[model samples]
Target chain A: MQDLLLYISLIAAITYLGFKAYTIFFKKEKSCGNGSCGCD
Target chain B: MKKLKVALIGNPNVGKTTLFNRLCGVNQKTGNYPGVTVDKKQGNFTHLSHSIDVIDLPGFDSIYPKSLDEELVVDFLKENSGNSDVDKLLFIADGTNIKKNLYLLSQIKDLGYDIVLAINMMDVAKRKGILIDKEAIAEEFGVHVVKISARKGQGVDELKSAILLESPEMKTDKLIYLKPENHGVLMNYVKECVSENPYKAFLNITQENRIPEINVKKWKTEEAILRYQYVRKIIDKTIKIDKSLASDATTRIDRILLHKVFGYVIFMFVLLVIFQSVFSLSAYPMDLIDQFFSWLSGTLSSTLPPGSFSDLITQGLIPGIGGVIIFVPQIVILFLFFALLDESGYMNRIIFLMDRLMQKVGMSGKSVIPLISSFACAVPAIMATRTIENKRERLITIMVAPLLTCSARLPVYTILIGLLVPDQFYYGISLQALVLLAMYLLGIFTSAIAALVFKYIIKNKYKSFFITEMPSYLVPSFKNVMLTIWENTKSFVWSAGKIIVAASIILYVLATNGGEKFDKAETHIMTEFAQLPDSKKDAMVSTYQLENSYLGNLGKTIEPAIIPLGYDWKIGIALISSIAAREVFVGTMAIIYNIDSDEEMKITQRLDSEINANTGERTFNFATCISLLLFYAFSLQCMSTIAVTYKETKSFKWTSVQFLYMTILAYVVSLIAYQMLS
Candidate 1:
């Protein structure tokens, strides 16, 4: 159970980090201060 | 349920967003200052068995567009006018300045859309002894009028009920007619166009330039004069002010607060108080949070089985998130002060105060909004530059915006200050708070100098003008201030937390697991120090294992480059990781220290107690902390900022120039600070 949980947690963390990086850098879709890009 | 689409339109800072918040229960950014809403925000609410969708639009002075965001509103209105796409228009007007606000309302009223003219800020107007004959105004304009105080929640229910009523299209009997004979193509185009309203057709044609032969500049100036003249006549008949009962309180306060010399003195004093309060007020909560996380980590370590998963939880995630969570008190306090200043209408005064200084630096007073907005984050601040009309000024504002210390850098500064600066007060001012203030001031000073440099580099002949309206001084709404704090705090944690947690997990894996040298570290340490006691041997082995770990090797690779700035391999690791975001530096340090240390301590404690094995000196000394702070202040560490800068400039050349200059400045400043202080 411990081993399985560790693997799952690791994968989840990696996946989230990967997705966040891709969105911020590649997709260029990050929001702050009203959560909208305010772009036309 | 019936579906209704109502677009909320008004002049800026006239409580359009406040009314929208009241209707939709959505906490969009509202301020006493203008141009807060730069884009149309949508929210839906169910009322009277009707589903109403509200579009909160950017406030503009005229029906015609001036800036990009205003262009969006004009386009939206043009598309939806007299069409089923938009069911009605909700025109919110400032009751105190109805004469000025009604100009835009009159234009929209002439557009032939069913309008519910909500006279907002009725509370403020009443206090000023101004009374509006709503019935007379309604009769004159041929639209429904509702008196509302969006701040006080007065008559909001009545306004909602009014919104549901299907009023007949009311065009003012007095129309400012354009010359059809002189502009034959415009009249012909308006007739053929789907828009039945010739005013809307004219505004659209001028902007779109379908028929370029029309003298648009002359026509626009004529239209404005005619509209304001009409608005003046309506106001004269419908509103009354009692001179005896009117208050000069706002003017009285502005006299002192806007004084030439005393104004700046008071502003500096206010900043000092804010910084001092941030440290003093949040100290107890920050300490409590720190202790709680330490206890939780210790408890989890003993309770769980001695395994990688337990280690990950206790060492990786807890410390990672705790590092960020510990600084929440400070972040909350900083934003609370900002929200209060914004809500109470003082932020506008600061803009007005700084306008002179900004002009001297070759920037308009309008540049202050984006520069100040950069305090929260540079991403939206860069986006907010859309409000600035001049190309050169806007570009300069964008280039220097990221130099302002954002909320992301707060955690890094807090921890570093906690490690290096004493908590004692000198003459009722906190030393730690003083250092923090210096960091912020450094950002402001650096950005101003950078703007001056860019003013010359990015040349433009077109001059920009600064015109800001001072909102009447009123007590900031308690509910709004609290909501602003709640919303910002939530955004900070969730946004920074996600990055911190992920970085912590990856760091833990790299720090704890390695192949050849990490596996043999214990044996090598024991053999090298055979005569040492078993306890000492264990400590040596732990140190050896960490140094040979994958993360350790990676840090060592870049350690030489950062060594001159008084940084070790671990600090180098943090520098590399924090490029994703600034707040991640604390989390990275937390994870790195928690993994190597035998006993659990707060990040500040670990950092303070950190020693160089070679020199036996403190790692985070005054010099190092100051260096780190300066680096963070000047460097463009945020990926979102870089991305948004690119999106805004749409030029790789400018973005690259901004990035290179900022990074080089950060390096040179850090190098000087570290070298001199040591």
Candidate 2:
């Protein structure tokens, strides 16, 4: 039971973090740094 | 129709690539120039029914050719002119910084080619309250001028139209000539070539004045100063600007950023922030990559038949290559920051601030750029040393560049620090991060010492000059940063991946298969140890098997030499493999321990269980760990670095000497470290 709880917590935390990163990197407004928008 | 060949020439950081992208439209191919390590990029586009072929020349200050990059550009212009004629020469200039840009433009104008001027970054100039009289300037120089904002796709069409209408006709009929007393014979040749058209006469003068042989003595610093003085006179008349405002603004900014006391403080603060972000921000991506590879290996192992095929997929390729690929995120993050700093023109300030400090250490301020860049990877950083004109200085820069802790060393350092150092904070600074920073400082200090030593040892007869330009600051372009990061990360993963896979497979085979004699010996050891405790019996069998294996024999042979440094045979094997790449040490250790352990165990757990039989002590105790860290810190462990040095120096003797010296340095330093720490 203890091992199962640990696995569940790990998965949940990873999923939350992955979702956050994806949103941050993929957002249209935020993706303005490189040469994308041509504004320096 | 014959393809029109055009050469794009400019001063550095003049929106040359932004213009190239605008004209060529993403259809580009990059390769090494013939017989040189310099990158060659060519792209084709159609403008007004003419097929335009553009060659993006490397950025250079002058055609007099001091450094390798400058020589490459100048040589290409000279050689290509001799072969196929250049249809049109496009000279791009930053509109905001026209004075420095025009110095190169005037030199190109004298080369006698059909020229068109593209005044780029017009938008930035307008915002900065600078007005450029394009028509007036064009009339002054006798060339077609077009205003362009390459980043915004503004005036590109007009620029293309102007290129379509280029003519090899001089705007002025009067010729201007410089009659230096030293060039008596060359002046006679120039006089013979002069005619009614001054542009033609100038071209003829330059052609006749060209030295057939590379007489370094013929060109001196005085000549360069004289040439620049002539250029300054031209700019004083042609260019009309509010110099007071520009100089005042630059001075105000320089006071804070270039301040002797505050400059280093700010640089350290920024560097600390960048390092912290590299570790903390890249962690999520690194973890994901690690987990993905672990799942992939597990899936392949379970699905494939239990044979060499599965072994190749799971143990040999995935684990080995994946370890390298996981570091790509960190490398990209680091490069992203570097590109931003460069594009925004802040890098010039860094050079200016560090010039005095570098001079004290027997290196010019220009060496600072290459040294900082070596933190990412030494290959490009070493390539960048071509910008340093002095042969001895360039060679010394390349020699010490690898000492700067590169991104490749990050994984090894992090893992070792995790095992060795406590994760505590001192006055709000992470202890682990401080240690990492200390390693960087050690690299810099060691590189400075090496340069000072070389200054006394190597005798350079030629005089070298240090001259650098500081461009006005602007916000960095996002597109350029992303493109740089994407290209560099792709190259790193691909190049490192290829070697890692092959090395992993070879290591796996050596650990798994001993000869027929070793197979018999392993059975004998297992039978004899059967009556002992299970843990003891398992260790005994592993030890016996390793003794007879190919790697074991090689390690045992080197054991006597490395034993004083507190390394066992396993460490000796790792050291041998690490010569190809330092990161391989961890992966090789993983494979060796995995093959010997009876119960399936994580690599770190198995390593923890490893003990020295002689002392009955933990093998990777504090002393040995410190020794290994110091060895890697000092050694030239990357084969790519040696190969690049050989190519750059064009001599096997220097490369061999460099390898021998670095290896000896690593051994002696590590020996001292182990003894003192133990």
Candidate 3:
């Protein structure tokens, strides 16, 4: 039972991290309009 | 037939790299600037049918540098006069912050180079209601102005075309010329030889005014106030801003985030979250790596015959090298967050908020980044200290940096803490997490105290001022984060793996063969234990033989001294071997116990069952665990740190002193902990 619980928690954590990695790559915002954004 | 050399210069966080990468398309190499640790990048690409090489110089606000790193960039562009390979300069300017960005552009332009301006981040300007007329800017400056968004790869073609077609123009008659005596007559000589145009005189004047020499010092004394006055006048005429648009947004955000009272509270909260994520989020990948290595060792041992080569592969190479590689995931994760925080421009605000308090602790606000990065690993942190120019200040920062609990010490701390500290909560915080937090706090406080002490003792003839560019905040890019993680993790794993594998093989040989003396003692000890119960007798013989071996004799010699610190002879042996790298402590313990056991069990269980002969007590008790923790926390355990220090300081004496001081400090601290706890 302890092993099962550990495995479940591990899977959940991996899934959340995967979501974060995905969003970091895919998320898009409008180009900063003011040359001020410093994103050359 | 000549190749054009162009430098891309801009303020930090101004998408300079994004543009460089866009143009060069992965044809880039990264290294350090000559004689300094600042990151240097260079790349080449063919644009507008002309092959051009772009040098991405470290970002700075002015040509007059206040730090060693900034001086490197400025000196490279100005002092290398005979190297007329640079055909033109592409000055990247952030359109929204045109007034501040132009501060650097104007300085570069006055050097009398064929110049073109890449007004980048046009997308951001539109959103912020900033209107810029490209034609008007071009006409006023008498230089080509191209709009670009490097991140989106906008206007790059035009930028490339402009560079190919650009040519030097004759200077205007009204250009100012100041022939100050101390302006290094060498620069004037070079300028005259290089250019037969009117701008040569103007270039000489700008060079004389900017470069620091004996004569320029006197000129600065007389016209000190006029420098900024000139800057202001130029800014007022070239840039126009609507004052009504400057609102309380930045201040309002700073109120809650940088509030004197809440600032520390928020910092602690955020730091806690980062720590938790580093441990919790990385646990799965770490476990997977651990399991994979164990399986590989078992499979290789089973497949090969019982011979020296098989033993070396399974016992020496796989477990030894794999143990160090397993921690790569955690190190990469930690650096990923650091890079994200740095790229998003939030790191500058952290420096600004902590500046006053850090100054009181005898460190500049800039010292915070290097010190904080030490948590991930100290090698890069030590390298990062190059940004600090004051020799005394840099040395002090380097001295205390190792006190911060680095990721290399994490495995040891986690094992010891799990065995000792409970998991219960105190005021909604995990007890284990609080203990971890306390350990981190201890490192920080010790470092600060050491810095304060060093500040008063070390006297040097150098002056330092804290000036940093505050970049606007933006979301971090995933591509950059992944690339940084991959590069850092690959280097760390490869370097640490080689050392661990070679050390493991040598350790295995020493443990296995002790010459004729060990063989004779082992036979006698086995005969003496022959009458006892089989299991008990086996354990006694194994322990006896180990104590009589060469490694055992070395451990025994130091055992008497370390006993007061709660370590048994065997633990002393492990500690001595771990000086090569702290992660080896667990692996050494595993190997020692594995040789003794009849049935192969988990390394943790084997260590848990071992007992000390003298006290008839567990070797890893609360007092012993805490002592070990304090030792690893303060000691310079990695040889890589020493190598990096030697490279940075360029002296063996400094590195040796750093190692000696840290080792001595670790010993004293551990001794006190064991005595008090016991």
Winner by DockQ? 1
| lDDT of model 2, residue A13 | 41
Q: Between the candidate structures 1 and 2, which one is better when assessed by lDDT?
A: 1
Candidate 1 per-residue C-alpha lDDT over B1-678 given as tens digits, one digit per residue, 9 for 90 to 100: 989988898888899877888888953443321454454478888878999888787887766666767777777777777778888899999988887777777777777788898999888787667889988778877788999999999998898888898774454554464543545655677789755567677767667666777778867756765666677787788888874465568855777799999999999888888889989999899989989998998899889999888989998999889989988898889989999999999999999998988997778998999989899889878989988868899999999999998999888888888878889999989998898888888888888899899988988976665657678888999999999889888989998888888888888888887779899998898888999999888877777787888888988899888989999999988998899899989889988887777875667788889897645799988899889888998999988899888888889999999999999999999999999998
lDDT of 2 by residue, B1-678 (tens): 546888898988899988998899888888888888988888989876888999898899876665788888876665554344678888899987888887677666655667789999887776555667777667766789898999999999998888888553555422233335544544455577553233333333343445455243344443455557666676666666553344345555766887779988888887776766666678799779877887887798788767654665576567677767777787888888888888988788888887777777667876888888888788788878878777777887887888888877876776666556776767766677767777777777787787887777767765454667667677888999999898878777766665565677666666656787678875786677667876877667776877778888888889999998989998898889877778787777766765666555445556667898656899888888788788888899987788777767778887887788778888999999999988
lDDT of 1 by residue, A1-40 (tens): 7778878887988999888767765685445555234554
TM-score of each: 0.72, 0.67, 0.66
B1-678: candidate 3 lDDT, tens digit per residue: 447888888777778889999989989999998777898899999865578999888888766576777778777767543347677777888877776675566556556566778988877665544566666556545568789999889899999988876543423323232334433454564465665333333334444553444365444333323344444565565556453343434434555776777877887787676666666667688778878887888898788777765666676567667657666776787778778878887677778787876787778876888887887678888878878767887887887788898877766776677667764656766666666777888888888887888788778775555757655666798898888788767766765555555556656666656757677764676676667776777666667767777677778889998998888878887888887677787667766666556555556556667787767888778888899888888888876677667766777787888898888888999999999998
1 or 3, greater by lDDT:
1
lDDT against true structure, model 3: 0.71
lDDT of each: 0.83, 0.73, 0.71
In angstroms, the error of model 1 at B94 is 9.0
For candidate 2, the per-residue lDDT at B257 reads: 86
Highest lDDT: give the candidate number: 1
DockQ of the two-chain complex in candidate 3: 0.02
The local lDDT score (0 to 100) that residue B396 gets in candidate 1 is 92
Error of 2 at B563 (Å): 1.7
What range of 10 consecutive residues in model 2 chain B has the weakest lDDT sum? B195-204
